[model samples]
Target: MLSRSTGRTRHVLTISTLGLTVALALSAALGGPAAQGRAPAAADAGWSSASPFAAAGSELSGTVTVPARRGRDTVVKLWLSNARLTSVPDACRSTVTVRERASSVSADGRALTCLVRSTGSRRTISLDALVDGEPGQQVDVTVMVDGRATPLGARLVTPGVPVPQPDLRLLSSPDFLNADVGDLVRGPGFWRPGRTANSTNADYRRALDTILDDWRAERPESVLVAGDLVEGWWGTEVDRSGNFGPDRTLAQRKAALRRAAATYYPQWKERFAERGLEVHAAMGDHEFGDNPWRAEKRRLAPLFEKEFTKRFGRRADGSPRYADRPRGSKHELSAYAWRPRPDVQVLTLNVFDATAGGMRIRLDRPQLRWVERVLREARQDGVRWVVAQGHTPIVGPVRSHGSSKLTYEGGAHSPLWRLFKRYGVDLYLSGEVHDVTAVHRDGILQVSHGGLFAFGLTNYLLVDVYEDRMELDLRDYATHWRDAPDGTRLWETRPQGMPKHLQVSPTPFTIGTAVVDGEGHLLDRSGILEQYTG
Candidate 1:
């Protein structure tokens, strides 16, 4: 049910007459960089998304972010470099536009090119651009997409440079089992159900806004949703009297879902849009009626797929964004991949493609085989990193029925896990159990980002990518603004588990970091990142 990426393979470099030492060892307990002896996960093939690192010289570039703060003018620094060029390359000047209009830009190559270190990997490219806008502005910068000009999308401006200055950035979370987040009428569970039962839309918005506020400097590129983006699957909406409500037919439920999409889909879409990230969602159990297989699936499947298509299907120009991706038809909007940058490939899985969790879940042969095909193509495309995302975890730490673990109903050791290892997937982002846990096994990392609907340990993952390494920062949304600037303060909680009786821990929010070396071939240090509290 989840999905999300890395960045460009370019760095700014100048023949550094003054070469200084930089600490390659970021974490304390990490040893020297692991050897790149393992054969490439798969042999490289020609790619559609051009890899600038492939040749000695190409337009090696990073993102240029401009804050869309209407009516005001701001400046942004775009770093660039060409390992093959001693001076400006042929396409050195990339046009800068705002709201699709051309903006004046002046390149400064004197100080920048000189400071770029001699080491090919240690070099950087620098460019400067100015942005002017009126108040309340929301516009885009144009970028070439498949010979077509497309908007670079909006960027939420930030103050200073954030660590792990990656080419592409993303946020991941799952399990949003609610419709009108503000009106998820609480059931007769342990706590009250009504309007204010769990987290209100306002609560999540406010908290998430606070977190983004800190990063208002520069928001991540997009979000990878690990399914369960909605609540109240067909039969789960029964009343206290056990009635399935008046709208019970497959046709009736479809209408209700369409109505819900009108209210709920925009809730998340707008939030993500404002934060400057397009949502690439997954198909969680909730999307499939949560309950076990029934004859109704025949009728319900098409309608459910229709709802997702309506909500997230097309672009403003009527382009079928969802349909354009992988074979997402059966579960439409459920399986797809987007390469934000040539070096990074983002793949989304339909956990409900073949089987819904039984008592435990399986990725049926179709999905498993389909995943392998995608990974193989990624390798053929010269992609250096692959991040496979789904809803249920192949390896999870929490104890929940939906979890795929040794004891959970969602059991493990399926063909999917082996594919992950065989393909050298750097990270498998998942979420079923709400607790934030990152585990490394068989040379692969599985970090279940905390869920959006849960108040307990609600968290998100921020990834920064380099040519040989990627950093996964598990950020706490609740304590992000509450913690001391250093994040040294401790916090605790005792919320009832999703099952209502399970006792939960009171662990304080902390920033967790996991590093992957040589295109995810090795997990450098599977531990927490203590330096950053903000």
Candidate 2:
């Protein structure tokens, strides 16, 4: 079933299981305009269709739609279904290509062709139509299936005034702990028949992928991850027998840390890229060798910080990746800010300050001063939304789930929260607790959420930033995890190893929601977050 909403009315078209050929034949017999390669009339509620096409003994039905008054970011959606091609034995072997205005739509900054594999009899393909044509011009869309090209439809729409600040859609999930997979550690670990080394649980990857697919379906512009992208026990040394070996020389430990970073960071990055998501990440404690930073681990904090900045802080040309940063500060790369739009400024802070004593979870004076300048400048520049993200929550008494519950030293009374209140920063997104908590204080809304993927409490926040208000929907995926065989070691931490298996429900449902107007006032809220509003 495909549904299009226009004004107050919604038009839905339900395609039957009779297959594409039957549907096309029925439409032709009924004299539907869509079968004739023309745009649907206004009564069709902006839905246009292409003549059905069949290939490789399979049939496909599709539709294309564009808003009547298009803007700079014109969104054209193409929905395809009833596609059954020759099945390949591999996990995924099918490709679907969509073209708009004679040019292939782009995905992941490349061509808009999607590689898909079928898991069921029916599949739905939703694509973003990248149209560059001028307003008042007809935009034509075509879909290529196998070797067949079918004209979806063409529609003429007037272009509206260019929007200075378009609505923004974002997904925020932190503590993604995307551990490495398939690396088998051999040694004298607990012996189980099929158990080998403690790599990422394959079952967990599938469950995570399911959640990622749901995010892709929403077509968010970007994803904001507050921290803990990996399980980072890199600096710790373990013998082949899966036992912690603290006697390794500093050189050996450093080499192992570097090797682990090289091995795991790419996997962490590729997961998001594979889903066609652009991620903006903050540095978590794990990136700096986890918390407590004992004397030995403290010595390696700078190296871990360097590795993180090398991957996330700089562009290909060696210039800083963020537009605004605290120049001359050691954390310039790890802590930075950027404006996604004219109305919104986002800052990601590296709150883990490596002191001679130990690691402190606080924004240092230098970074704090930079943040104040940035926020003051943003307010002066008329930015409507300022969002800051870090690993630990500054407003406390929040929830925790399978987490160390590391937080800023001062909690709500911290200098950072005070600055946020002074600057009227709209939202502070943090993730250390691994559970969802909402604390609105002093005009700033602090949301502490995101869960441990291994523990199966993985959740995310979908935020829609409109001109006058922002809507936040907190979604949680139900997952089941079981203990691995005894004696399984996962690198340095989890000597017995983490859960070897995780199973996630197919659907993630909204557990909490809130609406905040431009003035940072909570207009309404529901579910687990409502209690925190007052």
Q: TM-score: which candidate is best? A: 2
Query: Model 1: per-residue lDDT, tens digit, 1-534?
Result: 000112323332211111211212111111112224532111111112332122221222332222223333322212211111112211122111111111211112211111111232322333221212222332122222112222122322222222233667766756643233422332212223331234243444555454444433336676777777765354323322111223556555555555545555666676667766667777666666554546555356556666676666666575668432545345435577778788788888766543243323555455566778878888888888888788777764543433332221233466777777888788887766655556667777776654533333345566766766775655443232232254331110112212211112222122344567774444322223221121
Give the clash count for model 1: 30
lDDT of candidate 2 over 56-114, digit per residue (tens): 11112233222223222222222222211111111122111111221211211112233
Cα RMSD to native, each candidate? Answer: 18.2, 13.5
* RMSD (Cα, Å) of model 1: 18.2
**Whole-model Cα lDDT of every candidate shown, in order:** 0.44, 0.61
**Counted clashes in each candidate structure:** 30, 0
Candidate 1 accuracy as lDDT = 0.44
- On a 0 to 100 scale, what is the lDDT of residue 506 in model 2? 70
**Model 2 misplacement above 4 A:** 1-166, 178-198, 237-247, 484-493, 532-534
What TM-score does candidate 1 get on C-alpha atoms?
0.54
